[model samples]
Target chain A: MPFSLLNLKALMPEIFLVIVASVMVLLDRAVREKAFFFWMALVGTVVAWLLARESLDLHFGASYLSDHYGFFFKTIFLLVLFLTILISPGYAKREGFHFGEYYGLLFFAVCGMMLMASGTDLLVIYLGLELMSLSIYVLVAMAAGDPRSIEGSLKYFLLGSLASAFLVMGLAVLYGKTGKIVLSELAGWLTSDKAVLTGILFFIVAFGFKVAMVPFHMWAPDAYEGAPTPVTAFMSVAAKAAGFAALGRIFLLAFYPAYAYWVKLLIPFAVLTMFVGNILAVVQTNIKRMLAYSSVAHAGYILLGIVSGTKEGLSASMLYLLIYAFMNIGAFATVVLMQREGRVGESIFDYQGLAKLYPVPAFLMLLFMFSLTGIPPTAGFIGKFYLFRSVVHAGYPIIAILAVLASVIAAYPYLRIVMLMYMREPEREIKLAPSPYIWLALGLSALGVITIGIYPGSLLTSVLASVF
Target chain B: MEKVLFGYLALAILLSALFAIFSRNVVRSVLWLLVLFLHQSVLFLTLQAEFLAAIQIIVYAGAVLVLFLFVVYLINLREEIRLPKFLGSYPLAFIAVLSMLILAVAGLVGFVPAKTVGSLSPGAILKVGHTQILGEHLFREHILAFEIAGVLLLVAVLGAVVLVRRLREGEL
Candidate 1:
């Protein structure tokens, strides 16, 4: 491979993150105060973000690209990572698990997600996925003494490793059948190969596992509920977005010629994922578990766009994923704020009379809840509109209607939170440990959600234009 | 001679794999696994892949077996071996295994290696040497993957440290 200066410059964000994370890893051992590492992590993320902003336009190499599509997802990952770090220290402090590895692992996970977004080769994408998955496995298990955390982490590890196995197996089959590695070049050989067609099943199940589609979604809620709150927030947004990013690129680029076949395979999964996620979310009392199921449902909606197999559908999914990062981080930020002295404070009943006490966060949670349920005046509605419109435009009116129904069913859980916060009497006096950084993140997220909800025209046009 | 050696290696591998899975004693299973690894390395040797054969023996037989022996030695052996014996999923496992075995047999029966055209042929490997060819591929076309693997391993090390965090506290 020609190791070009241009390629390294294109990868400046990833390189910057590696250096920063390594420094922090060394500094973490020497630094006595966890707060010091936290500040270092924040500084590193800011520097990485600046590098990422410049790196977006630097495109080359046979394996990876630095185009608008990757750039869009990278920005979302960095924003989510920044917010996750901001919201993390408070909960880590409460859990007595505040340390350097948490932030270092988180940053590395962000790097992995960025790589996944940018990689064009199947090998690069797979390696990126593993790197990200490994970091998250460690981060999920970071709360050592907590059995829930360990259990969640273990479950995630087993299922995640299996998912990776499926992906590798599929990629191997594709390579064996077609002898091509780069996704763009595979389409010509892949269109005529039967074994490569079989390989497509592995890709579906593998990506489905990553995005938590229904049959493969069993591990998600346990992992989500049991993980540390900040990690939960990060995984629900950035990690899920990473899954869709790979899915969109691989299926769109490599399998575009075979779209008709994959679309048929994807439609039922979209419906099942949405229905199961929403219906199961209804009975969940824990906030994290509810969000896990809700995230699954959102993944289903995003898949609705991919299933259409058109640029319009693809653009719609891209736009929805960006909007999702803001709303999810907003909700989880409130969940972080609701934490008491010792616990993560995840039970829905914990939010009773929340409006009377922490009115600002309570109101923000309401906005997030509304956005999540596709109510107007929040970003989720506009996202849902474009996604379903594209699906219907692609001639799948029934799936769109079923999606509308699933969102309607999904409203119950979000509204239930709203009810507990606003209408119900206080079950007990809940003490909140407020972190200023978390508040800033929550404010920014709420602003993002509302601003995009109302004026999505410019962003929508750009997303549509740049997707090719 | 190569065919005869391949036959012996394949038989040894199959038997050892079966014994490794079915053996009740944990140490016995590890010994069977060692046999499987040895046979695999010999198969590679027969294929003229000397580098792979050497690495396979060194890594799998030497280093990995030592680690496995250490873990089996440290843990409660009898209790670990006696805990469970394929309880509920036996029938389902049987069905799945049978179908997969049939599929494997059919696939092998139908297998035909695709003939390469102007690519890395055996003559090319004999001339250029396997290690150099492997290095060229790794450093050239797959360099990005090579670098990413380093990142993956670094993450794993960090992960191991994280997992072992409360080891001093008797949590493990």
Candidate 2:
């Protein structure tokens, strides 16, 4: 219980992000150049990544963790942050938004997320959640021109506040029952008591809302559609990844005793979320809304991995989250580039016959779409394969069957987007002046998806090792 | 006498919490929240957590709720502010409260079965040796957690600064 600077050093990645965010905010005010904020965010994230890698060399044990799992997630979060900054510059410039505050808020949010991934105590986790949520509410409303953005911000704030209240209530009840706030201590208490089941249920509801699972997913589409494309990409990937990380930690550490309780509760929600998300996505014409529903389905798949309740299940969920970041960011990056004159091209009709006029951009979009649909030789396919295999291995063959069926049903909208690009005749000629950074993001994501699909041995081995 | 005083304080806390949740006006709700927070600090004091009580009052009631009030006032000028209606769900709320009361009673009853052992006196803190007992526990056992709490408070201060400063910049 001795206080040591070594403990502080273990949190270097989060500390670095906080420092960068502060500096970015100062630089944004001092310098008028917009590109500076973007580059600063990117460089800051890379430095954070290096710091996280360094932290992985430290010892990990109960109550305090520093290890491969945290390192892996920190890297993924940094990569997502880098891509978010890359795609944001053009959108920020076109929209006449204050660039520095945007990146500053982003870095702050990333810091919260990194802390959430690294936090060992329930109190720290709750604080991290609030930190992330507060920053994102501002980011969602950052674009002043859109009335929808304001509405989305209000809705997200209200609903997110409600979720936070539920989480706090759960924590309070758990603390009152056990006189402990650290997850390890709580887990020890849970072994002897069934009364803590109510607290666990409330915690599940809180996390379910954060991840946008079926019954709690009402606010997602509006929020996703209303935010700027880059912000949407960041929220979809980074926010959800952090949520999953926290969820995994809670289940593995605190709620392991009540696994039977949650497992029963989650199965129905997982199936419903998958079925509803896919069915809804099939009817959506708006690109953003479609992606939103797809996100819901992906949440179900992640939940499916959780329901398996094994170390393999947890590792597979992490892999799926990693792959999900690349596919989602690539998809949204293409969408961001398609914006012209501050108007993001969000309609499915707007994408029609894009291949004829903008071959390379359209092709890249096709690659993203294919990857999202879990086509062979893509990270998405491998991600789903690991998730399904884990579930089946855990004796949930029926869940895996439903998951495959849902994925097949979900592929329709993704393929439809690809078909619209490749097969349709042009109604209006479109020209996309590509940015090198955008191309760099897309190419990197595409290459990652394909490379991981072909040989997932190293990543899988590392992920498996981290879990055990 | 102490038991009666503690009972009155607990009742006040419960009433304020109810008022905070059910008040129609946002301003009234915030005021009730402040009262409830103050009562919470008193409870912390009763538990001999003086440091925590101070933080409870300063951070939650004094600083954070003031920010909430400020934001509420700033946004009050918006046209057609929708005051959230508490639908005809009073019955549900009543049922929830009733069930919680029943559960509390049940727990109290259950505690008696395990009470063959003599209970620790609530007034034992007045003993001279009790001060050392409390200090030893705080400094020796809970020291790491205590320091971490300090770090958390520092982070919270920084967060508040960032949020308020950003708002100022927006105004500029």
Candidate 3:
């Protein structure tokens, strides 16, 4: 193959991420300032977003499509990355972990996610998954002073390696069956034989682990609680988005024929994930652990869309991911800002009387909580509505009903946070410094949540057009 | 001769894979992985997939395994730590392994009878099905994916650099 600059242009987003991550790592050593790293990562993410947007004009054939679906998810990933970087400075300063390496690792991870979003080949997708997972393991262990972080890192590493092995084995089986590894070829092969069905099941299992569906979710709470707040936020939103993106492509293309076989399997797991996640969250005192369970519930909702087995279902999943990115990141940003003297207060009691002590953050946290609970006038509500509607449309009314029940159960914990913040008296006086970057992120996310809730038609139309 | 050679290679691969998974020592496991990788490359060669065989050697056996070995050495697994008594249920592990072996053997027994042994001249195999042919197909049919793989590799390289970058005190 003759390498051309034109070919490089096709990889603008990826190139941008790589360059930014490289520069960030180099500048971390040269600058000796933490704030600079944060701003650099933020700017890098924005630049990558712009490059990703530009690449939409150059969509190729089935083997490498860069359509609206990829761009939409990439945009969501970039937004999540920006918010994570925005809230990171405070957490990094407090935890004494403000290194350029941190931001660089994040950039590379995001780059991997974007690649996964656009990938049309199984090999490319696998490579992207590995890239993302490898960086995340390092990020989880980056907090050197915390034993919990090390433990979390080790656990995540072990489970993630197992998941990778499963995924690679699935790929091997699929390739052996079809003598092809490209998505287009696999789609064609799906129509021919039933043996590929087993391979597809293995792929779905791998994705289930990545998304923390019920039986595969044991590692999530510990990992979420142990990692720094910003990293947790990044993992919950960006990592989940990448996993869903890859899973969506595989289901919609390679495993379309086997949907009948697996949708039944997924429905039960989705129900269990939602039920267990919400019930567990209700008992959690640690804010991070609660959010972890909430994330598991959100994964369940996303899986509900996958079970719908229609273009509409896939579109709803994508829309839900956008809203999830905002809500999860905003929630974590508040957590990061709430830290005092290099330590985050994770217990629900730490938030007692916060409404009076820190009104802005308190209010923002309330908005995020409401959004997560899927209340009206929030993105979460709209996301859930679309997801349920799609599932019902696919003749899964019982599943839709169960989902609503789960959401109602889930809302109790989200509202509990709000009640603790606004309705309770202060145990002690607290001093809070408001960071402008975090405020910006919170405001944007809140606005996004509200706007999408009010008028979701446009986003829905775009999502439907992309998926179909 | 070709069939015998291929059978020997397949046996080597299966044996090495079993050793890699079941070995007590990490170093021995890595060695078994190296052996399996080498056997895989030979299988690629038998199929006249010279480019893939070369890639198997250079990328998997050479670069990736070397990196794995380096990390293993850096960690310096002390016997006390590495040989810690099995904390999980050994009986369960044994049962799982047994079930896996049974399933694998059953699947192979079912598949081997249906396999077609295609015969071609050595000249035809080398000339039409070598590195050049693979390159042509990769460049022509799968060009976009090929480019994407390049970008992915570059990102990984950059990511590794970022992960290992040093941080000074008070410098986030």
Between candidates 1 and 2, the lDDT winner: 1
> What TM-score does each of the candidates earn?
0.92, 0.86, 0.87
How much is A463 displaced in model 1, in angstroms?
1.5
Q: Backbone clashes in each candidate structure, one number apiece?
A: 1, 0, 2
Score candidate 2 by DockQ. 0.16
Tell the DockQ for candidate 1: 0.43
Tens-digit lDDT track of model 1 for A334-407? 88888765454789999999999878878999999999999998999999999999999999999989999999
lDDT by candidate, in order shown: 0.85, 0.79, 0.80
Off by over 4 Å in 3: A1-8, A60-62, A192-194, A341-343, A428-433, B1-26, B34-127, B138-172
Chain B TM, cand. 3: 0.67
Best by lDDT: 1
Best-to-worst ranking by TM-score: 1, 3, 2
lDDT per residue for candidate 3 within A1-468, as digits (tens), equals: 243333446578887887878787777658966788787787788888888888884644434557777888888889898888878887777667687778888888887887788888887788788778878887887766677786787788788888888788778777766567777667765632344555665676688888888878877998898888889999999999999998888887777877788787688998999999999999999899999999999999998888998999999999999999888888987787776754446777788899987887888899889989999888899999999999999999999999999999998999998998999998965666468888888888888878888899988898888873
Interface RMSD of 2: 6.5
Q: Tell me how each candidate scores on DockQ against the true complex.
A: 0.43, 0.16, 0.26
